[model samples]
Target: MSVSFHLCQPGGGASCGACCGLYNFRDHSRAALTRRLTAQTERLSRAPHTPEAYGEAARELTANRDAPALFPIVRVCPLLGFLDAEHQRVGCLGHPRVTGGVDLRDCGVYRATVCESFTCPSFGWLTDAQARLVQAACADWYLYGLVITDVEFVRGCLKLLEWELGGPASPDVLRERPDSLAAVRRLFALKETAPGRDGQATVFGRFAHDTEGEPTPRSLDYAALGTRAAPEDDVVLCLGYTPPDAPALLAARALVRDHVRAVAATFPA
Candidate 1:
């Protein structure tokens, strides 16, 4: 269960700017964000169980609305800060200043029970090498991995890929299945309609395939999972990338599409 977080790392080349500033806060108002910061501050300040470092950082961030180092140009979470003037590097202000130390998750501000329990759907299930490759893609700043909604199905696909490739599904697998690149393109083209509200047919079952072009943020709708009725509950699928020349990534992408198509076949039109 090797877990890698692009946003949590400070000097890590793959750090994410999207989570705090770009899309995550798109719907949040200033007042709402302030309320959230205040709540997090309060949680960090609580007694006996509180980490002194977290409390201090949270209080400082909450009290100073215009903390220059704490606020990025994008106006994201107060906890975010840049290591360089160019803002090319960014990380959590809540983190200890110690060099090569632990991340914000290990710090006091994030020790709040709710924050401790939170896990993004996009966070798990990859080999260390796979994780590094994904992070490299994410370095483009325009790229982010999608969360797979059908975790079991996706895992199954990965397992099948590994079996077919005769090892961990590394980029090297692409050499054996050069056609996988084309398969990936084909999979992205397949779509189906799912029943939306009031008997309306909503088109879904397509996965994003373009990793080299402009970044397109998309969500998955598991219309095949007829038991679940809400879009939020739908299984998500994450698209990860390796270099365009890497065969494993192409193979993995093709496998994902093939699995998705197989799953989509199970649902009633």
Candidate 2:
């Protein structure tokens, strides 16, 4: 089964991105390389880890330099496929609502079996189950608009997880909220309460082919997703923000249930 070009759903297949030259994004990586080449003199760059200090850089972007990527430092090297040359309005093509016009295999990894193969070391789930849940939740959060709400340092975990999963590692996912990542973590982990069909819902946060100006946006055929249903106990790992150890795993599970109740309270359709 092919993955959705809009939301990167769980399936088995490769995208054109893996074959960049054969695909349209051949120059996408080159453009970013050029930008970084002229951007370095790393010996002179300043590091700001504190929130107040971070605000200083944010001020510079909005008031002085007019730069995009407004946040503290990001460790992810190649932040690619941005909305503009400067990347001010970053977009995630993985969203079905956004990339409804794309074509099949137009993207690279999102449309491939990379999900089953991609694993982030930062996730360091103490147990296989925790790791699996985190993986599952991330996909759900990206594919579905499910939101996870909680107070734990989960958002931090999500950032670390995303980093390991080869995402931009940009703090943008946190959205100013300290626990934002954690919310995503929890939302993705609630697979137990998920109905039969919702499990295979396409996650758009992974692919954004439409935003890349493809002639016609494409998404995985949702009608056929049921045909690709995962087996009974072979958890797809793209579930949620998981803990590193056993105790933490239990805590993460409880948090997910609590969060599900809150979300259901607001929208019960």
Candidate 3:
């Protein structure tokens, strides 16, 4: 189930800390996460590189964590922070590569071995091309992690595009053509741009926590909305749409349709 390429920190302006529980917080918006990571980076940069100092800093950061995890069961690491002075990348600050030959990830939420070995579902679910396209489309750490970690959102968008084109919407092709890649980027940008999905921090794209605190895939209540299911519904749900009624559902579908069509339009006529 291993992918041919690395999805985490694949370069070309892409990096991810999602496996470290980057997006587990309730307010995982770009602004909130930037503040959190910025604070962590600044604080850790001043601490001694010893395990004792790093562990204490980790505890203090967790104790003063800005927001509670949306999923209580998930572990959010305090060691995740911006890897660059410009704050364009996010990664494990405790990694030996960042800490100048000292591995301090053991001081974070998980052991160093676990952090080194763990691979998210994306490693298996996403092909090299798909992963590369996501990397290319989302250059910023915040948006890159948001879209790359969600395999369903990436796959759902591409599948819908294939349907719209009445043919294959190859990820490799999209990656090569600037115009097509730009269009595809707009489609993937729906992860952040889709409107009216606020106030539902509990809802992570198509999945929401049940009473037991486990994620469960949400479904469109067609019977309640009086509208039948559509192809775009999967992407719509992955976009975190909880449409209240038929009109709302249709609007969400239309939003997805426009983006999908835009990508398809870039194909040869």
Candidate 4:
């Protein structure tokens, strides 16, 4: 149910100049993306009665045609568009705006689970860590929980992943088999989401092993999620089939790891 718009800028050289490369810093914007997101999110300070309220606040930022920092001309990135005005988050950006655009139900971004689940590896404001990824591995668990609210979060995600990978999630399957819940909890503890030069995890996401040895991930468009991460990635097989091409979606499914060491491919160093 997700529709994606992608374009690659030629100037994005092999070094990923403004390409929005996933898991890598394609380029940095002079603007403070995090602050923008916080300001937008505060729209719910009064507590919106419906999703429409959320969508409207997000689009206010999107309407910016001039500020490239707000809407960068990325070569490769899913530009999440606001759905029709219904969820109650649309068209209330402190000015007169157009209404009757799209519905919150059909939003191009969060319509698919993949887009909602993915997070960017943001190494924001953390100075303690030499590399942002160091903070990333730490804060991932907390952010992971926020994305999915199921009680057995990781277990459910993996089970769904197993089924999507052309495998079934049997009830008798081990609950804490892949990574002990304890271990995962420990990892979250190490995560520091405080404000710093070298920040915590930048992104959150799911990936699929493509025909090539690449991990294809969905668009982690936090902008649509009502948050913002100054973006950029390739392909990976995820249980959530939401490629722009619905027909090819089934194809992304065909490469499921049947006799594969499932977890090995997912958890990378």
TM-score of each: 0.36, 0.23, 0.97, 0.24
Where does the lowest 10-residue lDDT sum fall in candidate 1?
Answer: 191-200
**What lDDT would each prediction earn against the true structure?**
0.37, 0.29, 0.89, 0.28
Pairs clashing in candidate 3?
A: none
Ranking by lDDT: 3, 1, 2, 4
lDDT of 2: 0.29
Please report the TM-score between candidate 4 and the true structure: 0.24
Candidate that beats the other on lDDT, 2 or 4, i.e. the better one: 2
lDDT by residue for model 4 over 174-207, one digit each (tens)?
Answer: 2223453333333222212211213212222343
Q: In candidate 3, which residue ranges exceed 4 Å CA deviation?
A: none
lDDT of 3 by residue, 206-265 (tens): 889788777788988899999998989988998888998899889999999999899898
The digit string of per-residue lDDT tens for model 1 on 176-205 reads 243542332233222111111122111112
- Could you tell which candidate, 1 or 2, scores higher by lDDT? 1
lDDT of 2 at 92: 24
Model 2 worst lDDT run, 10 consecutive residues: 14-23
Sorted by TM-score, highest first, which candidate order results? 3, 1, 4, 2
Predicted candidate 2 versus true structure: per-residue lDDT over 1-269, tens digit per residue: 21112222221211111111111221223344234322321211232333343334333322432132211221111111222233222232222232353322213224324323443332232233332333334533222222111112234344344433445333343333335445544545443333222222222112222333333312333234333321211122223222234444344444544553432333212
